[model samples]
Target: MTVLFWVCTIGILSLFLIWRNHSDQKKAKERFRDLKKTQYGASPNRNSGEEALSHVSHFFEDHRQENAIDDITWNDLEMDSVFARLNYCESAAGEEVLYDFLRNPCRLNASERARLERQIELLQTDGDVRLQLQYQFYMLRQRGKFSIYDYLHLLDQEKKRRNGKHFLLLFLLILSLVCCIFSVSGAPLFLVGMICVNMITYFQEKGRSDAYLSVFYYVLRLLGEAEKLERIHHERLQETFALEL
Candidate 1:
């Protein structure tokens, strides 16, 4: 009787956790879509391709300057397309170059800085273009530098959950042995211990399984984000400096 009660309790808790994880994933996809839309609307000089992205970093750096560019001119820049480029191109120079540039656009030479300045100066003539680019640059610059360590930490957490699962299994196995011993010896209370062990084991496995799945999902998400950034860099670099060689 005790073992039956334990199994029932653990089964209920496990079901709840699985449902929660599924709900969270649905919410995540919706949020990412909205984020992509917002990023696109803030981009500049769509017709000019990646040339606009260099200006994009600048526009983000100084939002006040965004007012200098116009709406029509700003709309010409396709933020989504740049994002798509970042998503696709695998070349080190393509998407990777932009990430490298963002890591330290400050290291650029006097001539390079001057050229970017000249470009921005020209873009500022339009009110919408200037404002849109400024916002994007500001936000991205603040997103801070990417760190591999941070991602690694997320990975470790997932592993930790997986490791814990083994202990739960071992506990139930031991309890089962005790239950068998009690049955033969006519020890009535041993049934109670067996029940407790079964219930705890079931609940623990469910929780750990959900956590492991969540961690794997997060890893996939981060990779997708990295891809988005990469594509933008590749397309933009080609347009801005014809760096395709």
Candidate 2:
């Protein structure tokens, strides 16, 4: 009777976990669909169109180089619409790269352009491959507009000094550990006190560190996305993935 009850309990728990995961995946898919609709949907007004145009223009202005595709040409060619059509990228970095590619038409020679066209054709025809890539990108998408380069530049501008408070906390933590190992009578009390001090110090220092921490988080996320992309075995994207690495 006990064995049967334990087996049933494990089975019930497994089912519950499976159901929860399925539900979460369904919600994620719905959200992704909604996002796609919003991105590609018809604008409700001329104002919205102008807003989007301005946003794109501003992005180019900030990031453009001498050889990059100019605003005038981009507008003339209706490349915004083109980008919307071709953008199946899941990550912010991928989207930005696609935007750059569209705006600053690379000086690809005839043979190279043909090869690219063939790769694009492959991407279009292979739904499974596209879906896999999109899933990867979705996993990598940030909650807000994150410009990697901009954040990196900000990180560079930050001072290189270490916080003495952090060192003090670290020393206390080590001392507390040593006390515990030596079976010191007041070790637990000292550990608790050190924890409280560290918590107070942490909150006080958090404001200054938040920006740097956010940049580090995004950088780590980008690296993870790149690693995933590199693992995907799509011939069309082989060269592109290599470049990303």
TM-score of every candidate relative to the true structure: 0.28, 0.57
Model 2 residue pairs with clashes: 69-104
Best by lDDT: 2
Poorest 10 consecutive residues of model 2 by lDDT? 44-53
Model 1: residues with Cα > 4 Å off, grouped in runs: 1-216, 228-245
- In the range 1-245, model 1's lDDT, one tens digit per residue, is 99999999999889989998989866765564455446643533224345533333332333223233343543576443545444322221233345344434355689888777765554445444433333333223221122323333455565433546557656656766776776756444555665676678778777756544644554565555455434444333334433222
Against the reference, the lDDT scores of all candidates come to 0.48, 0.69
Instruction: Please give the RMSD to the true structure for each candidate, in Å.
Output: 16.1, 7.1
Clashes of each: 30, 1
RMSD of 2: 7.1
Query: Worst ten-residue run, lDDT, model 1?
Result: 138-147
